[model samples]
Target: MLVVKHLSGEYEQRDPRTKAYATKVKDASLSFETFELSQIGRENNGRADALSRIASAETQSLTGSIYLTEAKMPSIEKRECLEIHQGTDWMTPLKNYLEKGILPMDRREALKIKYRASTYTIINGRMYRRSVSQPLLRCLNTEEQHQALEAVHEGICGEHLAGRSLAFKILRQGFFWPTLKADASEYAKKCVQCQLFATVPRQPPEEMTSVLSPISFAMWVVDIVGILPTSMKQAKYCIIAIDYMTKWVEARPLSAITEEAAKKLFLEHIIL
Candidate 1:
């Protein structure tokens, strides 16, 4: 059981100076009111149920018209409300809330949808965001596309196209995809700037097995050069170990090849 007491008091009539001070003090009091409701557990189930029933009944009886005015009401049609709540026509209330400086969750969702719609592009039979200048440049075939894609591929693999879009936006003036797939592929493959930075030398396929000589260090065939200067481990000179009987030749580097290294190679190939 709870008891709440309400006490009332009246202020005495005051002098002008005193009245002004009192009015000022009253005005200075905090303008906002705040309340909090707390639920308490009861020992008895029956008493709790009765209290809950009473509370529910009181709540149902206290209902009244919300946002109703005595004077002329603003035009809010029932159909509009139904559309906002049920159907996908959500612009009006969102705009109203935004205009009133209120940011609702629904408004944020609508804003996301609008942003995505504005930034989206269709490429290779799939829809992607036009957040990148490259995709737009790909559409427009602008001179800046190569530079943008180079920067994108530098930091990101082709797998993370979405993440690279922001980088493209930072590089050049944003545009739409204008180039065909073949052109785009050629640009990616041939971009000199990207090749200088990110391209790796491809390893050549192994040659078929050939016959070897019998004796060790007998027919020492020395091939001066073969492969290009751009190849990885660019060997300019080669020392070949050939077997007289087997007629087999094993060629290796001569630039930095040491005696121990050659001996190790000979042991692996000949001694074993």
Candidate 2:
């Protein structure tokens, strides 16, 4: 048997027999955004645009290992793009100082070498690194860098793509970060959708637990449950007792539960 309560704005009382009837309840729902949907859409669009920009390069089809993004192509020349980053993440201050022409001790030492000196240089409030054929596009900030990776890996233009492909696409589009490949791989592995659809593991991590109760009636458990439909006798709750060793069970219904009722049940069912 089931009890139906009217949830509609107006308070209602119905006869006991009307338990099966449905009552309209007032709408009680709250709404807020957990993440900015607009921002996600923008990221997807950016991914699509980047993919489109590299569509020609993708057609060359030499090997999956090769990147064909416009940013990574050999034909592209070195350039600098300066932008401010706003975040408390670790990379913030380092990038800030580099863009401001302040090199850390390690970079200063490395820059002293004639060959390595041209590797890192500042232009127009931005840090630029000259690679083999093109300058690495210093990522604007961590969020934008993450967004770029996510866009390439799982955004609209992405078909839930793999880490390698995602990283390649981002690189081709001219973005550079410290752990580009590693970050892309980790992100792909952690994608909730990918995990949801992934194949199940064949092996269990641990062995199953062995049962400890060896004899019947060796252990017992008891509990009260329910705001059940009130019967003609006004019983709307039940007290249940179970013997762990024997799997024996007993129950009694009640309209109300009290210390006296519980004591009575315990004494009658277990103590006796």
Q: What lDDT does candidate 2 reach at residue 108?
A: 50
- RMSD, every candidate, angstroms: 22.6, 27.6
Per-model TM-score on C-alpha atoms: 0.18, 0.34
Local accuracy of candidate 1 as per-residue lDDT tens digits, 1-272: 21111111144534555454545444554454743223455665576676456543645454464232233532221233433344322233333333443444786765765554455444564333354424343233344455555555444544222323434443344433434344445655665555566546576577667656565555554343434353466665565676666557876665554576577657787558
Clashes of each: 19, 10
Q: For candidate 2, list the clashing residue pairs, or say none.
A: 7-25, 7-26, 8-24, 8-25, 8-26, 69-172, 71-172, 216-245, 217-245, 217-246
Best by TM-score: 2
Evaluated at residue 172, the lDDT of candidate 1 is 44
Per-residue CA lDDT of model 2 for 1-272, tens digit only, reads: 12222423133546533322332111112243342211235545786666666656646655676466444633223357887765375344455455554554676543544343345555676655558887576654677778887777777767776688778878888777768888888898989988888666878799877555777767778799999999999999999988877778889998898888888887887778
lDDT of 2 at 244: 73
Instruction: Give the residue spans of candidate 2 off by over 4 A.
Output: 1-117, 198-272
Top-scoring candidate (lDDT): 2
Worst 10 residues of 2 by lDDT: 20-29
